[model samples]
Target chain A: MESFVDVFLFGKCYSVPDNLTIMGAMEYAGYQLVRGCGCRNGFCGACATIYRIRGDRELKVCLACQTKVENNMYVATLPFFPLIKEGFELEKVSPDVSVMMQLYPEIYACVGCNACTKSCTQGLNVMQYIAYAQRGDFAKCAEESFDCVMCGVCSSRTSGCRRSGTESSRICSPRSCRSPWRN
Target chain B: MYTGEILESMKKVEAARDANLALEPRRMTAEEKDALLSAYHPDYKESEFETLKIGVSRGDKVPHELAALLQGKPRIGAGDADLTKIDYDTDVLIIGGGGAGSSAAIEADNNGARCMIVTKLRIGDANTMMAEGGIQAADKPNDSPAVHYLDAFGGGHFAAKPELLYKLVNEAPDAIQWLNRLGVEFDKAPDGTMITTHGGGTSRKRMHAARDYTGAEIMRTLRDEVLNRGIPVIDYTAAVELILDENGRCAGAVLMNMETRELRVARAKTVILATGGAGRLHYQGFPTSNHYGATADGLILGYRAGAKLLYADTLQYHPTGAAYPDQIYGALVTEKVRSLGAKLVNAKGEVFMHPLETRDVSAASIIRECGDRGNGVKTPDGVGVWLDTPMIERIGGEGTILSRIPAMHRMFAKYGIDIRVEPILVYPTLHYQNGGLDITPDGMTAVENLYAAGEVVGGIHGRNRLMGNSLLDVIVFGRNAGRCASEKAKSVEPGALTLSHIDAFLKERGDAGIEGDTVSPKLLPVYTHGNPDVPKKPF
Candidate 1:
């Protein structure tokens, strides 16, 4: 009669058992892993978590090997962050929208703070793909920020998207796009 | 970074991709970059040519080589790893966690030793996180390190390995200032300098990139400075076999756990084998950008623990991958889009070869322009060429091909094709594995304290591999196999790891008679389910 679930992970509340998977509730809370785990399958975005549930003021984002562990969740993962890297010279920029408005001038400090599309747990629309990459419509900002698993949790609850999940890999340039055998 | 004295002090400098003499729409002549450096040389298929010309691809290993042809499989057997219950005991175990086992567990925990890093997956998933363009370093200002060591052992045909190509051309600009003191934001130049470009066989513009995910920003900044210097990793796990000690050295590794198919024994007095290479043994059928734990499992557990695997059948394909959508098929498209000028064309758009030549002559000019000068472009899994990529956003502007090939503008905008406005299709996949585990530029191998780094060590890029010389042979041999295996793990003394060297390497592959079926090329047969083509779903 399996059913348990407390969670609160890196903050200790454990319990686990039911519906597991926050990498099986952090190895059922003993946390043997030396670093945040990876490729637990949902395809190498290397985990990417960020949660909060206790009463849900809403701050989620998925992939701790594909979601699950919930009741009062709280989680935290991110794998690797502190992103914002600029490094210029695409021939002095010009693909429109002032090239992400002069290398992330915080994309015009958008105040429409939908707190990064209400903390996108893959519902995307992270402020409509930063307003479709500020209207240059980079092919619908590469088709609605292509399932953004940047996991900087909508650039840490964006107020204007400075870290935009580590500068959305500098206006996103996708990879591991699938195929080459692997169902 | 171009040299020949900076391409004779420049002239038509339209810039941003420099090893000078601008690419196509014509300008090359340094004797046409010395006649596109003698292009073309990929001949196999005589039933993969006597298993790659007399085994281990012509370096000759014979006796059940290619990692002792995967010794007696069915694991956890012989004493199901109780070896006095080691469950990990370290001084330096480190085995393949990409970007040379996370820079040899941060240079063996900064040389005081105690390192760990185990990995098969997670820990910046390997293929050095799909190394997108940039990581060759002669460190600009008319570059040196002897012209990046005469353009890396004169682009491989020189059959490299001279002191591991003089310690990867004298420690690649101090491993690019130690990956810019471990932050890896690379590109630089609004008066800050650094930015050097140009790839394939090169003579200068010493690569150095970060813009296009340069190996996912140096394998996520060396897996985040080896997990912020706490350095302990075991990760999903994999080591399969390698225990050695009774004087053959290597002492640790048996590990396993690829998701609880449990098994253990990690004793280490310094092992290292940085696992990489075997391009998932897809070998000559192609399609592979590697990284689903590029299964060689440390080259057949470091050749059943005798180690010395040079040129294990030359591989390196990457002359631009992505054979077409299906998720993003075979990945990679970053030789910084032909050193930033883009132009490989074919399907009648013309322009054959000389797209900066040199990845086995631009992958043997797209396998001789799609076999026998027919001029490629057939594609339903073969024959192609046409990288033009909207002429680097019409000559570097309009977000210059999404800011200098932003991971090929997010892998051709995941099939919707916006590689900064069209033109993508490519070929040559398989990318890097030039052959492995045969170290010694102080990265050991040949047994003793094991050691190996990056593409799982081999004759440092010899049967072709120049495009940014494998992220500068993974941080100058992962800081010389972590400071020479932490000064040989301080004169090692911790012994005891035996299965009598896997029963004398299975009685020396059963007295050199050699047979098959011990598997562990990670137990063969894995088309995995992206299986034999089905993908089409761009979402």
Candidate 2:
């Protein structure tokens, strides 16, 4: 017989197989998810989740597709992140901090709470990359934030900058817009 | 990440590295290659394939999983979708939002054609985003399109269609230039010369990349370009069935809103199916290195619309998929690792095969090593050989692995395995559908006005694809499909739209005595862990 563990999905308790991922456990509990599921692998970043252990106040973030179920785990899926990307022609723009400021505008609003860094599932130094964007060090920001999956966990935990800090790090990357400084 | 006995094998690999550096495995002769493939390749296992009972290629043999999908019933009845109530209409309708679809939309828009993209997931969520290897383009002075074509033809065992192969190799350099103009960051030297490397079966250094995130970077750039062009993209919507016109030319498709379970009709003068490969089908129950949306949707829809398939019996298994750690099983370990200098070693710390062999030969050799010789490392979940990754750092000095393949380093690092310091366990995983809907040089299917591109179309890579050609194939054929479809759309008028094809398909299946309880265009794979037998129904 397969051993089961009790997990609370949005505060409702269900017993699912201990070996299953949080995604599989949700399905085992009969929830046919439409939104909080994507590329069952770790690449897509569609299944960013927040959870806590029983009687533990330390919150953790992970991709639900990758995390295994734990006994008495409390899970919440963040399916949609409110991101309204400001459109700009990548060809005409340079990878400068001023361009990022013009597009996002809120990059200066970061209060250095470090919550964004703590919430990152990819383990990226979110605040450090944002600091790079602030100082016009786009190359450094690009290299540091190359692993960003755009999961929006950093924005979800922030109060001042919303998503601009993380978004600026991505915009600085040469992958999106070219840099005249680059040889 | 290895410990205990596996770590001991790692030590053996380390002890043999200096000697293995100079090792050169003998190349296989044509007769030897044929014998090895026939004996070990998954496609050569005759029992795994079955003849199709219905559709344009009725008697063709495809894998058993594919035969069922081809013979399966449509998701909806003919009466359920009203073609007259067109929800969205455009000059060109592009299905799928991967690299091909995005490229098609951009090209069509450039030709003054109004294009609307309908995709199952958010834009850029197709298999194109998962590709890690660089793209092939014979732009170097030492290389020419003729040489690239010859290499590809030989690698595919001379089964690739001549004209299609010619077009792919010829257009590749220009395709790379196009992506560069659109801001795709290819790895380049200080003087702006593209830094190129050799992929499997390549005679010259023609593979261009932006490190290991080559596809991700290209995809994001294309997605940005598509968005910036102000093209309308309908996300979370899939084309469940193709709508044929009264004249039997492909006209439009029935779109399913995956979230709302609502059906909508998209009528277009020309339709392009860029829906990608069938890796997510997990053919023969093999773990796949495909995106979740790669369930052979376009193949099923196109076949039902009377398009013939080419080389449907073949699939390409990427030889280096992560074999240990159940959570990350079957994830692709890019062939760039080998292109940079990593070698494949058996559990006994012996260099088994030349690392740069074509995908099929490499996969077969790995299987032969594991099965025939019992030279694979046994794991709790399965068996795999060592992809001696640390040799890359040793050959190129430290920090090379981090600079060149950071995505790979980070992927393993997440699981507590630092690939820069340790080797990874690997086995072949289903990676690409080498065969799909047959198309002309310009990507037009047998059904007039309908087009296919990317992995959804076949004959570009006959029975097996070399490492970097797939990325090139998408851009080359994608632009072809888009330009031709747009030009064709200008001269044509939208004919009567109907879903009578579904009725005809069902009738044909019934008449052929093909009985099965399956419905397809299987948009997603079911992962209800506790209830494996539950039917696949959208939430």
Candidate 3:
């Protein structure tokens, strides 16, 4: 027998298959959620969200990439920007030059949304560097990126940005990014 | 003018003219002149130095007539020979690339002797990288080395070597300072003092960490230091046999390059075996967190080389690993969790062990409870118990918990359990080995030229190792063994071993198995024959 799962996103509820992941079910429901450069193995913590199951009063947190959809579960996707100040660690960032280039393109996608810049506890210009990276000027990007402690705060806030798509809309598709070669 | 032999004959004439000047000259025959010209200027056609004009001076000059003779040559090897097979006569050769081997390499290098490190994996990929707890040291104002030594002795059931234990406790703080100088980012307090926390079987808060990844941090720093100093690291090279000379002094080793199936002989005056513990041979349900490559290669190599093995039976089982069905089921849950105030509970949600008891005792109690199924708690997966999450939430905020311990959150989520809201299913798993190749306080083995350190050595952790002390053991004793090996290496000369001797060494290794065959079936004899009656613990 196939089990049906009802996932409540924001305020709307939709039924999904038991086997589909929560991120997969959200896409099937026709809502477009902004996905980051998805390293779906769950180490990146890019797709993290606050979730709760209906009638199960406990609040839980999980990465949407790894979590499967549970029946009658409530998930609120927090944008990647707001979480930077609280969750970023300076030490985890790779000092690789090539990885810096791969992250350059999306950094320019910042729309002057001070949401990430202001959210940075490290006081970095998250908005300015994104603009610089988008312009193909890396020197400026490197300069502004200095303050980034790589807490994933900017990514966390922008992950579910309202401007990219409607909050009610589910986004389930994975984004493509260049792979960093292992030396 | 002069023919080639006539010019050589003129050199004989010059020698006769300067008989009182202590000069001897010989005339070249026709064939010899041709050979000398061909050999001295072999690459004359490709010579860049041939462009230079020759001149003569009274004091120091080259005769223009001999300009062709002075032309540079392209040096070629005697034949198409394998340079990697060229025997390097060094004073010491260290095996294993974890804390012990690396320390020995640094110590040997600083002591002005040629040193080489052959590791089964990358230099830093040993159990040292997987250590999550901080290193323990007696750095607190309230703590003393005597107290620390007593604690360690008591924990090990007094089976630890008193001298080694004494050296480890006293020098551990300096080792920590050495790591700091090497750029290990230890967690710090507001006043700039190193942050200390608690762990199993400790009276003081002596554990220092970089969040939960203390071992990773230490290994990274040490690896960087090793690299910066230009120490030769032969990665993916497994030491298959310890080479013993006729006199029975530990000499060198035969290594198999894992990438290429090639056999090479490393001839050294001294050899140090720093291969880590054997943790993967245990039965199921007992989590062996050791890397797949850690199969007691060092122990077997040392034992075959005639070094006496000690305390091979005592294994330390960490009390908290994620329960079954998870891929990392037996993976370590940092003891910092307990230090942060998490408690062990049975299925009925009652705290079972006296939360402050030693790790071995607590682990035994948990094992007993799971076996008995008392307190309404049945083993979840033959060894499962539960950890109360409410306490974890109270001590570490949910944000801190979610951020710092993302794995903990993932482990619970996999089981359909929310750690923030419910109890976590846990069990004891193979964590660390308390025994290995026996060594002196300076890490010298019974074999004259051999030494051992890190998890590969025994008596440092008698029965149970404190949470943070494992990292300290790697650095402190690793440095000690390294220094000792270097001193021995400096005074010693590479012994004379002929081609026939090298062939014999290669033949002995050939009997072990195929070169670079890590999966050789011949290993069965070493495994099945030893300690048959004793129940093996997962390490």
Whole-structure CA lDDT of model 2 = 0.85
The digit string of per-residue lDDT tens for model 1 on A5-59 reads 7888767786766555677667655454434444333334666777778776755
Per-residue lDDT, model 2, residue B111, is 99
The regions of model 3 sitting more than 4 angstroms off are: A1-183, B1-89, B283-285, B375-380, B396-407, B410-418, B496-539
Kept native contacts, as fractions per model, are 0.05, 0.37, 0.00
- The positional error of residue B283 in candidate 1, measured at the CA in angstroms, is 39
TM-score of each: 0.33, 0.94, 0.61
Find the candidate with the highest TM-score and give its number.
Answer: 2
Per-candidate Cα RMSD to the true structure, in Å, reads: 22.9, 2.8, 28.4
lDDT of 1 by residue, B399-487 (tens): 87665655566545533567654567778877777767777778887788888888877788776778878878877887788888988
Give the Cα lDDT of each candidate: 0.64, 0.85, 0.58
Candidate 3 positional error at B71, Å: 61
Candidate 2 C-alpha lDDT tens digits along B178-245: 99987777888889899999898999999999888888778877888788889999999999999989
lDDT tens digits by residue: candidate 2, A127-180: 888787777787777677766766677666432233444643332222233232
